[model samples]
Target: MPSHERFRTRREKMLGQLRELFLAEGFASFSIGDLAERFRCSRSTLYAVAPSKEQIVVATVRSYFKTGAERIEARVAASADPAQQLAIYLESVASELQPASATFFADLADFGPANEVYQENTQYAARRVQDLVTQGVKVGVLRPVHASFVGAAVAEVMGSIQRGAIQEATGLDSAQAYRHLADLVMTSLADPKKPAHERRAT
Candidate 1:
């Protein structure tokens, strides 16, 4: 391979490693030098990923969430049932977030650019949930509850989760909170006239 190709591959690998490190331990405390040392790479090599530590954090965080969203959507797409899609969506989100430590969430909230990425992702998630709920209602699988109202309520709860308010009030991390949200949403959408076992099968 050419030198540039090798460098590109190495940089991509470094970004993946850095993302895992940040997810496990948070990015707020890692200086460029510290990251370089930890990765056993030169400062210039680290600069290949981003121009600065802050930018690196932003890039990594953005990539993490972006990849996670794609995976979640892929899972949702595989399931044909709208009701199942709603449950799968939220559960997939929880799974994607399971690796992130509390410190990572704290750092994400503290940092402006990284926090923006997180907030944007959360907003998209809220909208996706709303779409799923709408689909469920259209298919006559869910109760005829107002989709717009459900969307707004989900948006508020998601925003609170992003801001750490949910954690403060419920003692649940983002992943666990999302699981509970899945349960709550599914319960609310369940058709009352359906037998309990029938509802569970959906």
Candidate 2:
């Protein structure tokens, strides 16, 4: 590859490694020197990724969420059923977030730039849930409930989860909380008059 291509490839690799490190141990405690040592690279090399520790954390967090959203969408796209789509979306989100340690979330909340990325992702998730709910109702798989209302409620719960309130209140981690939310949404949308198999489809 050309020199620029080589640099890009190495940078991408470094970002992926940094993302995993942050997810497992959080970023707030790691300085640029620490990260450089961890990666066996010079400070200048790390600086190529970002100018400072905070910027690096922000970039890695953003990259992690971006990759997660793409994966979740791909999983949801594989299922044709509207109800299954909703389930897959939420479950996929949980699965994607399962590797993140509590420390990582705490650090994310403490960092303004990183927290902004997280907040934006949460907002997008709320909108996606609303769209899925609307689709389910249109196809008669779900009851004719108000999609926007359901979306808003899910958004509130999601915000609470992101802020550590859900963990404090229920002793459930973010991933487990999402799974429960998926179950709750599916159960509430199931039509009682339908046959068991049909209901199960939802």
Full-model lDDT for every candidate: 0.89, 0.90
- The positional error of residue 131 in candidate 2, measured at the CA in angstroms, is 0.3
Model 1 TM-score relative to the real fold: 0.93
Clashing pairs in 2: none
Q: Model 1, 33: alpha-carbon shift in Å?
A: 0.9
Q: Report the lDDT of model 1 for residue 74.
A: 92
Estimated TM-score for each candidate: 0.93, 0.95
Error of 2 at 79 (Å): 1.0
> Whole-model lDDT, candidate 1?
0.89
lDDT of 2: 0.90
Over 52-171, each residue of candidate 2 has an lDDT whose tens digit, in order, gives 888888889999999999999998888898888898898898999999999999998899999999999999999999999999999988889999999999999999999999999999
